[model samples]
Target: MTLDPEDSKLITLARAARARNEAAEGAAVRDETGRTYSATNIALESLTLSAVQVAAAMAVSSGARSLEAAALVTAGEGPSAADTAVTGELGAGALHVAGPDGVLRS
Candidate 1:
């Protein structure tokens, strides 16, 4: 499938970010004021490109189609780690993009 210019740009940016991280030898974070940073920050930025790709593909192919059907057949089936990631707790029921109430408590 052909990629839109914006999507292409995002992918290029993602690749560049990956390359930069690799070049830094995975030094994705540094201590500045007795704080811990994470490579995940960069990784998440890079991940946005891929997510956009998925969204674009869905919009085009799923035209006039039911999202539920798409979810069942086209969308990758899996449990979302959102809950675990947000709650800092594992083995939770009903994987979701947000916590049980759709708000990530800080």
Candidate 2:
């Protein structure tokens, strides 16, 4: 079946996430939340996101990626133009994360 852009994106994200998770599992880097994150860690987290969770994760990850990309740029080690373009297209902005928390009774 042909998928919408969102679905296509989600599928790509899911596949990438699964691959990253597998790599991380092999490396045993599953509990490094307080330490330096491996590339697998970052990729896995970003890829494993569902369409529903994309917004929040993207909000945080997008900022982090931007910061990282900027640092790389300054250090003369930034991603190539194609990388930037692809990453820009995949920013968390593509997800829907906002919704009502709950209904309050008066």
Task: Tell me, by lDDT, which candidate is best.
Answer: 2
lDDT of each: 0.24, 0.27
lDDT of 2 by residue, 1-106 (tens): 3434433333344334435554321110111121111222233544652222232234345343321210011112223454344335434222111111211111
Off by over 4 Å in 1: 23-106
TM-scores, each model vs. reference: 0.26, 0.24
What TM-score does model 1 achieve against the real structure? 0.26
Cα distance off (Å), candidate 1, residue 77: 13
Candidate 1 — what's its lDDT?
0.24
lDDT by residue for model 1 (1-106), tens: 4433432333343334334545221111111121211121123544632222232233334441211110100022322243123212311121122112212111
